[model samples]
Target: LSLTLYALPYTLAERIAGPWSGALAGALGSGGAFFLFFANTTDYIPVLLFSFVGILLGFTLAWWRPVIFYPFIIIWNFLLFRLDERRAPAQTPHLLHRHSAFWDEFQRLPLVGLDTHLLLVMERNRQEAEAAMAYLNTTRQRWAARAAQIEQDARQLMACHSIAAIGEAYHRLSTSEATDSASALLRSFSRISQDVDAAMRQESAYNRRLALSAVEDRLDGLLRELTRSNDRYAARFRPIAAHWREVVADVVQQLAEEAEMRQEIDNPYIIGVPLTEKQEIFVGRSDISSHIEQLLLDRRRPPLLLYGQRRVGKTSLLNNLGRLLPSTIVPLFVDLQGPVSQARDHAGFWYNMARSMIRSAQRQRDLILPPLARDALAADPFTGFDEWLDQVETVLGEHLALLMLDEFEVLDMAFARGRLDADGVLGMLRHVIQHRPRWKVLLAGSHTLDEFQRWASYLINVQVVHISYLREEEARQLIECPVEGFALRYEPEATARVLALTRGHPFLVQLLCAEVVALKNEQPAEERRLARLVDVETAVPRALDHGSFFFADIAQNQVDLTEAEVLRLLARQGEETAVPRQVLVDYFPSLMALENALIRLQKRELIERIGDGYRFQVELIRRWFARQPA
Candidate 1:
């Protein structure tokens, strides 16, 4: 009883203050228990020693592994209880009767202690769950912000008017890493934008309607996709989709109203700018193309000259030669009016040439040519260029290359300015013509070989192919049907009047017909479709005003003082009337100077000798000259 009372404080200290503090108190309790046991009897000395060893093992385990220590403590207590039951069976009943409540309270202590470990595990799980929820919330916020940015970019795409601006907005939207539905919808909008641009550029209302119908079809598919998708951002895009539909409908209605106002006032004719190969309005070059093809087949492969007056479709012919020639014959067109003539040195010139050749081959025939770096031509440029041509020839295989140099006069200007060496440049061309059997060269210019004496000396056996006004039938085709589903019709007399005024000149024909369409548009809708002779007459002054640049170039640049006087004299004589050479001689002091001016005027195709007299070649030009001050 004394030992039990002394051990009570030590057991309570072990549960409350941990093993080290409890050990100090336990030493005192153990000393008292030993003293009491020795005083009473020494029979339980082995059991006391065994109990001390078990307590030491439990402390050792608790210091190393707290998890194992709890189970060890439970097992050790059970073994001790069993041993005491066997050794003190007679005393157990008396002790149980006296201390039943105390033993029951002691058994409940382990259950209460086990709850601490479970509480620690529960706290760790709670912290992990909270961290996971925070990450998910942050991810959701980031996705929402990205989706909002994509929506803003899509709105900017819709507001774009030009192809360049639309493309830029689409680039931003695509790079935003939008959802699949958003990407698909952006692509649909891009297609619709392209279709609308094409429709606005179309000359015929019928063609415009076809393009707009394509836009409508694409929009319908997009609407169906939007309906099927359950994307979170779907609600955000619904209003934008509806607005796009309304915009397309408004475009359709506006085009319909415009169609009714004027059937052909969209002005299909291209003025000043050279016609592209794909343009349907480029008509009546078959004869010139055929002549060029025949010359190309010559055994000597002479350097051909496409000689014509200014604005006579020379560059246009060069641009379209790929379509005219056989597929085996590749046309590499270099426009000297651009960077080629502007190059400062031989290396720069050859580099630009190579670049143009490569681009032209790819664009025209889908043929990939070997690349040439500008550094490759830094030293010995001509030799470097020649070596590159060897690679080009290997790519050509059995095909022939037709190199067409347009506006050769511009390159000549470069030479005259001393920016280029005339001898070195012309000699290289001469060497190419003489040495390269698989290559043919064609130079298009306004001046004749005789005018450029240097070119006359270098390019021997040059065949001249003159490009003039269009044929009568070709002019008619251009007038009535420039493109498929042409909206305007021409009466026979009206057509004949156009032929008289333009003299079948390609530029003048388009100019006069465009003016006639403008005139008819001002009248009632009923009179817009068919052009009458009165419409042709009423459109003349407007045509002259609209084509003032074409007319003024002839007076200011193409002719000198003597040639201008000769033109004015011819203009004074009516449209059809011709002045005899004898009449022209009276206006000039020097006969030789008068004859020289007449020869130059005729060579320019501004005048023609008709029945021993010279008359204006185009009536429109004559009227333009008549309006000019003497």
Candidate 2:
């Protein structure tokens, strides 16, 4: 009973530790029971004391592992006289050694390495952990540039006001998306790509306008599908397309209905937007037109250089040249800003010029040539442009052609970039003038005459007409004359305030007038005018939406940070005379630092030189710049 008590405690303690520990406990408990069976009945208390002490000793040795549980068990039986070994001097065999044979049974049991098994399991789990980490690291994000492009495409869709422009825009977007894997929406969008492409591919159709009309229904469905798609890109940009879809559809429908009767109509109060031949609302610039006509009538018909500040009606002047010039002069206007920008070489420049010249002629006058003549002109028209012009001259015998190349500054930059051949293009212009006497060229830019020194030799004989801001009378006509057709009127003081703000600049006058008119329109029809000077004054500050202006062309594209600071300071001055150049230099560390920036701003027409001072050339620009956050 005493040995049983001793073995019970040790067995419970060792079993709680480990499998190996539990085996040692069992050995101890069994050894104690054997000792109890053989122990003397007369000295039970002494025998129980020895059993407890001996079982504890065996358990301590067995726990160390170096003694090993099996070895401890064998030693235990010997010490207790339980084993019948050949060397044992005991008279009878031990009960455990002979009858129990527990050690023999334990040896027959299979061996296992629990520590090694645990390491293998841990290694497998590590592989699963690494895979989970890799899955978490993977991303389905589209790049920022791709999102920007989609936004750009959406804006283009909104701006495409023409029938052909809409079809062309859709086709271009689809073609771009085929190469673009920006998002899953774009990838899935290719399903109807063939339909969009074939519909927009107007060249393949027999009747161009009719083919476009047929595709309108299909295009509407496609746009709806685009709006319904569930994608991050769609979520970002689909709303922009959807918002404008109705407006765009209305415009397309109108253009389609009046395709035959449509004529270019000029809005008298057009601001930032250039006027076109379709518009007849020319408010001023009679003086500039007279000067250009006189220049064209000169013996040589020398190139006329028209230079002005940004948004000062340079494009409007070019657009109205056909109507302004004598019918005999046959004024031809070509906006080479886009083509010249994309021009790669002299050939490309000539090709762009020839194509524009041909297109303008077709649009203005239904000038037609024989198919053979057209074919000859089409083949290498860049080099054979003079020949084509000679052919055109023959077709319209004695017809004087005044080719007006608007936005010539872009062409100038093209030459500087080495994308256009300096000698070849300039020489071509000089040669065309020398050879083709009837073809009169008008070169207009926002830059000063000195900026044109790069092509000085070609323009040596050209007449430079410096465009000035409108006179007060002309500015008044723009503000008050538009009211005649629409039954609107302006207060005398309102006109005076407009003259004060705009400084008779054409674009600013248009913008200020448009703002006042928009506010007046919101009121009752009778109240829709600048009759209330108070109302006009109040709306001036709120009417200027920064998004409506093309400040990006100035802020990001043209000026550097230093030049922008010069503008900001000038803006703060608010209609005051320009700050002195020396004072501006003081703001900078040195004169040399601001010299390039000043020149750049001067070239872009953002700021102008006035005596020893410099100021923003445009009045509204000053107002806009002042509003920008520091």
- Candidate closest to the true structure, highest lDDT: 1
Estimate the TM-score of every prediction: 0.64, 0.55
lDDT of 1 by residue, 1-630 (tens): 434533575578778996555655655555545555566565777647745754453344334433444465555544543444455333422211122122222222232222222222223343432333333235322332334345555567656554334334434444421336676466556556655665556654544555565666666766776777798656666665566666666667777788765454555677676776656678888989999999999998899999999888898888888888789888888888889999999999988888778767865676877878778889889999999999999999988888888889899899999988999889988988999999999999999889899999999999999998999889999998887777788999999999999999988998888888778878887777899999999999999999999999998999999898899989988989999978888878999999899889898999999988899999999999998887
Q: Which runs in model 1 stand beyond 4 Å of their true positions? A: 1-266
In candidate 2, stretches whose alpha carbon ends up further than 4 angstroms from where it belongs are 1-268, 340-349, 369-383, 416-419, 546-548, 577-585, 592-618
Among residues 3 or more apart in sequence or in different chains, the pairs in candidate 1 whose N, CA or C atoms overlap within 3 Å are none
**Per-residue lDDT tens digits of candidate 2, residues 1-630?**
544544675568655885456555655665577576866577677666766676665565434443345455545544433222333433332232221122233232112221222222223343432332233224221122233345444555556554445445545452331223233343223322333344344321212333334344545665576667764465654554454344445644655556324321212355556765544345678898998878877887577789886777888878777767676776667787777458665555565666667656654665643222334435564456666666777866777887777887777777777787767777877776777778788887776556578677776677888786888888888877842454457778888878877778777777777667556656765455335678657766764672245655667766778888888888887775798988898888867769988888777667889999988876666777888887
Candidate 1: 10-residue stretch with minimal lDDT: 93-102
Error of 1 at 352 (Å): 1.5
lDDT of 1 at 299: 98
